[model samples]
Target: MTAPLLVTGAAGFIGMHVCEQLLNRGLQVIGIDNLNDYYDVSLKEARLARLKKHKGFRFFLIDISDRDAVANLFKTEKPSRVIHLAAQAGVRYSLEHPHAYADSNLTGFVNILEGCRAVDAEHLVFASSSSVYGSNKKLPYSESDPVDHPISLYAATKKANELMAHSYAHLYGFPCTGLRFFTVYGPWGRPDMAYFGFTRAILAGETIKIFNHGDMQRDFTYIDDIVDGVLKVFDNPPEADEAGPAYRIYNIGNDHPERLGYFVETLENVLGVEAIKEMYPMQPGDVQSTHADLTKIRRDFGFSPTTSIEEGLKKFADWYRGYYKC
Candidate 1:
């Protein structure tokens, strides 16, 4: 019999999708999440309700930062593999709530590492972010690029998690992989994200803020592609080498970057409503552009994202109208 897979933040956007994919493959899943009020708690519960119908899925309402609680759960489950996705997310929110980042990203990550160590999990995969590329002059951010200059506290904590996981992999013998995701969007996406916010404002006839005077480009990856890439990496754990730690980081994103102006135009076309753009200077902790170089991930895991902005936005628009009944 196969061991159950442990997924943190199972109530989150990507978490819910990942758990569903695993369960559909006839795998047992044990999910844990505190379901904090970072956004609407109702949305989180709605996501969880979908997973509840699967007999192979079980959930625990717990925070990863609670060290003792995480330790106890790990001791009980002792899962063979774990996917840690629970973190205090939001680059801008980190500016206002710095402690939240420390509590979840730093402390909570360490607790996760200790839990993995306790159970001798074969593989530990976690979420990193493209924001860690932080003002790099390089065109397309690569896995080998230097990430020492993170502009936001959120990015800094993600970079720190990579280093922390490396130490654990080196000290122990388990494999660890960090996935640096670009702008991920689709149905059931975070409301704070620009795509969702733009749709809401366009429907309400409100002005949407366009930062950097609309001189931005993002590698807008679709959520399905992200899940596929993640599952591919999970099935193949790294082998420890004598030269370095058994830890690898990959940039999981759409290779194509869409211009911010074009992105808004696509959304406008899909929703059939023109957005009132209020051009403004780039805010602090915001970068001008992001593009991912998928050489390593492709070479290693044979994974590549294949979703276009037009198709992805159309799917999102269809879901948005039905969800809001607008």
Candidate 2:
């Protein structure tokens, strides 16, 4: 029998989607998640329930930060590939709960690296974030850009993950790929995200706060596009080159960026309800805009994001209403 693929954060928004797709391809998947209360536990559970319906899906309630547990699971499962996506997410939350970031992003990541080294995994694909770009003035953030200045603790930790993964890949002679996702949104998205929150507030007839006084833009890539990019990168691992080991990083995002106000207007049109908007100053640890340069991913894997913001939001709105019965 072929070895099962191990996916950390199997219950997460992206993790669940990745797991489902892998399962659909007739591959066994061993999923692990602490199921923390970073957001709605029920939502996470709901995602897990869907994966459970797949015959090839297996789940373990384990936190990657728990070194012994992670090591044991890797030794037992001996997965062919590792997809590490679990992390303490949220830029503002990282500021308030710095310790969470340290435990999950730092310690947990190290534990995962050790697990990969133990199993000599074929490839390790981990989730990075576009937040690592900081307040970069560059129109489209590229993978080669110098990401030395991260304005938020979350971004710093994600940058650190890239560096850490590189060191492990070099030392252990394993292929590693890091994907820096930009503003991922769509069905079954995180409530902390702006679009999700805006939809909720609009339905409640409450005021939606527009940060930076509505002068912001995001390269919102739909969930399906992100999953497509991830799977493509997973199938093709990096090869060792003179410049570095078998390690590479790519930005997974929709290259097109949409302004915040225009995004809200589109959402309003989709939901068939106008939102009461309140303008506010830019929040700390937040950037004015984010855009991803897909040159490398496009050249390497033929990755192309086909979902428009309007179509994606409409799908999200339909799912939102049906899921919530609102």
Candidate 3:
């Protein structure tokens, strides 16, 4: 068996999926999450309940910002690798609760870093976001592209994570990989996401807001695809390359950017319902489009996102119906 892994935010949407994947591969996992009610605590608990069934999995209800708790976890578990997914997410929510972002994203991330350093983890993988490519207007955002200007505090935190990881990689000779995930959606997805909200509104026969008059586009990646990509990267850690900073950043996204209207239409079709559309101006801290350049990941690690939106939406709809008894 390989060395055990530590996954922060194990009860979260992405973290839960990652833990499941790890357990399925017969890997030992130690998951940690605060179970904060950023959304629904029940959903987070549900994710934890599923992970508990795996004998190879262990969980701790510790907030990442708790320095002592986080450090103690690393000392006890001694996990060789770490996947830091715990963060204060959501762009709009960041505007309302700015301090939450600092506490979770900044302070929490620092705690994770200190843990990784103390444990001398083999590789550290953390979540980043496409929001870091804020207002680029570029067709395909690449790791090589500059990401200095972040529109929202959430995006800024994500970008800061990359920088923080890079500094550690350089200073400690630690191998760190930062994944800038795109629009990840599917079963057990976050309720705050647009696709999730859209599904609920359409089902309730409520009008769904169409920002930018549906002019926006996103690389709506599936949760499974994201998990697969993450696992692949986890298996292959970046070494101290001469050019790359002993740290690597990959954009984990669907290379195909689908129109917002088209995505909503696909969801509606899967649900067998038409959504009441409400046209609106672009909200603050919102980007018009996001397209990822997957060349680096594809060439180096054979990373490819295979799920199309139609097929993905159908699966999501099925899971939603069964999960919610809709």
Give the TM-score (vs. native) of candidate 2: 0.99
The residue pairs in collision within model 3 are none
lDDT of 3 by residue, 286-318 (tens): 999899999988988898889989999999999
User: Lowest-lDDT window of 10 residues in candidate 1?
Assistant: 237-246
Order of the predicted models by TM-score, top scorer first: 2, 1, 3
Displacement of residue 36 (Cα, Å) in model 1 is 0.6
Give the alpha carbon lDDT tens digit for every residue of 260-281 in model 2.
9999999999999999999999
For model 3, how big is the CA root-mean-square deviation?
1.1
What is the clash tally of candidate 1? 0
**Where is model 1 more than 4 Å wrong at Cα?**
none
Q: TM-score for each prediction? A: 0.99, 0.99, 0.98
Ranked by lDDT, the better of candidates 1 and 2 is 2
Q: Give Cα distance to truth, residue 69, candidate 2, Å.
A: 0.6
Candidate with the greatest TM-score versus the true structure: 2
**TM value for model 3:** 0.98
Per residue, candidate 1 scores C-alpha lDDT tens digits across 1-326 of 67789999999999999999999999999999999999989989989999999999999989999999999999988889999999999999999999999999999999999999999999999999999999998989988889999999999999999999999999987899999999999998898899999999999999999999999999999999999999999999998887787899999999999999999999999999999989999999999989999999999889978788999999999998998888
